[model samples]
Target: MDRSKQLYEQDATDWQRGMYEDIKTTFRAPIVNWYFRSLTANEPAFTRYLWGQLKPLFQTRAFGRYAVSYRDTVLSAIEDGPADLPRYRRADTALRPAEWRELRGQLATFDVVAPRLALTFAVCDRAMHGDLPDANPEGAPSTAPLPPWLDRDRGQSVTMLEAGDVPGDLSETVDEIRAFHGLEEGLPSIYRCLAQWPGYLEPAWTDLEPILESEAFERGCRDADAVVDGHLEELPYTPRLSPNDLAEQGFDDETIDDIQHYVRAFNRGAVSKVLQTIVTYAATLDAGGERSL
Candidate 1:
């Protein structure tokens, strides 16, 4: 798979553009994530089919509650536990009011998408591995109707600095991010976006880096994974992403292998770490009342 490839929204075909719009609407965010974009680039038909199969997992009230729970899990751990770091606030930086607002809005987009991505990875990872439950577990919760306005109108489209374009002043921070995520080259999209506000991203990473390395943060990631595992049976629609299923849907063997490899790569460690990092960074902005809860 061409991991670096991305199908930008402006470059999408009409059908792909429509799908992107539907994705933005369904995600309740203004931007499509790299996962969707990369999949679209690989094969628009499979991406469309995969999205349709996965959409129901995010639509139910149970999933909304899961999103909140996921947020609270990370925040409460940081706020009440041994992360033991002082919360960084908007005033901690010299950002102008407008810049702070834009920062907050962009961070909010990451915050909202974090949990959804976690769940998506969970479903896709398990499905790709044949680890999904064959039937609803005995005591799973109902796939309740989704509550309206859960994180609606909260976040703006996320914009990121290119990995190569990250300012030299933030090289240490960028290096730390790349090292921690085990990337030999290029930074994650979240860090690239955070790089846009070096003053904020620098201190935030300084404080967050230790916690991300801590036992508490590790526990939180495991807990986050369990939250999704615990809900596998309750998903309104299980993803039809197994190799056979994809092949049956006209995906070639190479595409199926690539999809599986990609899903597993994102699912294993990267997505949860990114998810938690986004949540922790966004929580810091709200710590001093600069952002709404």
Candidate 2:
């Protein structure tokens, strides 16, 4: 299977599409993330099993609080920093009122998904490193229902521009993003989507680039990692998708290695930083009130 290939929602089988719906519903967001789509593409069975293994992590009230805290911590980090994030408005950009609203809502969606991805990667990273959580901790977090207010349909469907689809003038912007995220090629879905609105993406990146490079952003990443770790410590139950666990479940060594490779790619430095950056961008738009948009 091509690691880069993804079984997007439209191309998925009926059953696979149903699983995607389950994921969206469980995550309380409208879109399936790229990580899961990639996983499903490469190995649907393993992806399904992995979802079952990790679903418990997201279902608990503790995880809900963790998600909220993760967003707050990222925002607080930005707020506490010396440079203020430029709060761009509809009037400031060339987008029509509807387009501006769509941009804000789309970013708001990313805000909701960011922390969830953080927790996903953190759990996978720890488990793969042979530091599995205790199945039965002495004082586990509550297994109560997730909070009702947690991102219930807050974002619109996510769409992104293909590499060829990106405008020529925005080449500098694309290159800067690729360089910042250390990508040899290709932009992340978030940036690709933002690229559809050059009016916003260009200026926003101009203001955001320097701040993302600052020591302050680095500190925020560290602080956000700590917040994720703190919540992982409070997990009510362990996730059973470690390498050993996968082997026991009859996955081949090659399959295990492939899983590890993908997990490490997303769980490493760049994904988390991008996740936090998305949150910071979304929070800025959110401060002005989504209703007014």
Candidate 3:
């Protein structure tokens, strides 16, 4: 076998092994388990639903690799510093007040909205390719066509985010994409509680009375096409929630403030650690490195 092919195979094998071990030991068995337990104690159904949602994320090699690659890309962008970063559209000007309010309402329903969309993408992508490892799924799949919702000039007026558009609220963007995929409704109440509580324990009883009583919200929840289209129509230009708004919506203000305070701390620490390990490995590649390449 060619030396380059041998090296590539070795690297792929090592990556797969390491990723599987890390996910099973660190992510699936412990962190995710604990997260679900804490967030979904009351909602057994929601807990089960979330596990179902995460099954593909845990099982798929493509998703595992994508997580690491996306982290690296973000770290690299951070290292490049603010001046070199691409200009993102200002959320304040991009969306009007009524539009922002609508987006917020959608976001309030995000727990159900996001995971469904992710599932749709996963299913569609897998169906198209027969569960084969994506040729280049580190970020977005280059071969897979953009979803129908994102097509430009389609009379839907959806915002098409460029590859580098870094929004202020990463979570919200994720939720919006989930909503676009028709996977965003009829999620179990426990899943809803998990969305509300996240790492913390949820309240024993959810006030489902409002949701059950509201004809409009219930109808919106039921109409999958309308919900998807509504989100798509507003995507072309929507405002991210401000920090105060985020706090009001139950995210930890102190944590967000602290992270904002030290924007590059993780890049300088965790990311640099990974890069240093890579450099050390590279240094050991003697003169034959060039020939091998």
Candidate 4:
């Protein structure tokens, strides 16, 4: 399989695709997370090896409950940071009920999934890098079930747009996103996924572009990581996927470290930023501001 085409979910195996959908259904997300996409770029062998062992952990009924709770703690990490971002509502459009529903679903999906995935990537990054997380944090976060309002819409799945599928018209926007990341690591999945809803993209970029270039926003990411990291500290992370395990599985130091690069980049660079943006977007919508666009 070509490395370029591998970024899309459509090219994966049936079982691999099923696993991807299972994750989406569990998290109520409309898209394949970049973590899995990056992992499966090579015929799903490494991904299958890693996730097969980890699936049982997610299958535990308690895991979903814990994930929802953990998400809240992650959001709290930087919920109050300065966006310094002007709201860019759709200027020429009024959302129909259906559009509103989809928009709401999209926002809600990220609200939960972003943070949960953030913690997951964090654990995997540390594990692969030989940084053992504490079995329990100094103050572990609660694992309470989500409240009725928070748990309401589980969100319908949508067609995920790949990098190559981005419209020619949006090339400039994609360029801006690349510039925002400042590391040439590849555009964030949030941008590509949200581009499916251009109306939302208008506002999302409006808010994110400025903040992504600023000093305070970086600090906010660190702030959020502190909170999420504190909670994740308590994860009883398995050593099966650690550096030692990868080494035993025939991966050399460089190979193991390469995996860590993807994990760590997605964990620190994309996941938390996407979470904060989604949280802020949800807050704006819920406030019932000017309705049009």
- lDDT tens per residue, model 1, 120-232: 88788789778887646233334666666787878977888887899998998888888887778867778888889998988888888888888787777777767777767
Segments in model 2 whose C-alpha atoms lie over 4 Å from true places: 135-141, 287-293
How many clashes show up in model 1?
1
Q: Give per-residue CA lDDT, model 4, range 1-293, as digits (tens).
A: 23343556677667888878776654545667756776787436667677765544443323444554444432343344454444434343366667766766666556556655766677777777777564552222233333334333455555457778887877777787666555365555556667777666665676656655566555656665675566545444453778778777777776676777777766666455665565545544542111111
Which residue pairs in candidate 2 have backbone atoms (N, alpha carbon, C) closer than 3 angstroms, thus clashing? none
Q: Which of candidates 1 and 4 is the stronger one according to TM-score?
A: 1
Give the per-residue lDDT digits (tens) of candidate 3, residues 1-293. 11111111123244333433443332322112122233233333332333443344423433333333322332243333322222212252255555544333322232212223323333322222233232323333322322222211211111223323433334453354234323343322223322332211111112222322244323323332233222222221122223543355455655445323232332222222222212111111110011110
**RMSD of model 2, in Å?**
3.0
TM-score of each model, paired residue for residue: 0.92, 0.93, 0.23, 0.71
Best by TM-score: 2
Best by lDDT: 2
Where does candidate 4 stray beyond 4 Å? 1-14, 53-93, 137-153, 160-175, 183-186, 207-219, 250-257, 268-272, 287-293
lDDT of all predictions: 0.78, 0.80, 0.28, 0.58
CA RMSD per model (angstroms): 2.7, 3.0, 24.2, 5.6
Write the number of the candidate with greater TM-score, choosing between 3 and 4: 4
Q: Give stretches of model 1 more than 4 Å off.
A: 135-141, 287-293
TM-score: the better of candidates 2 and 4: 2
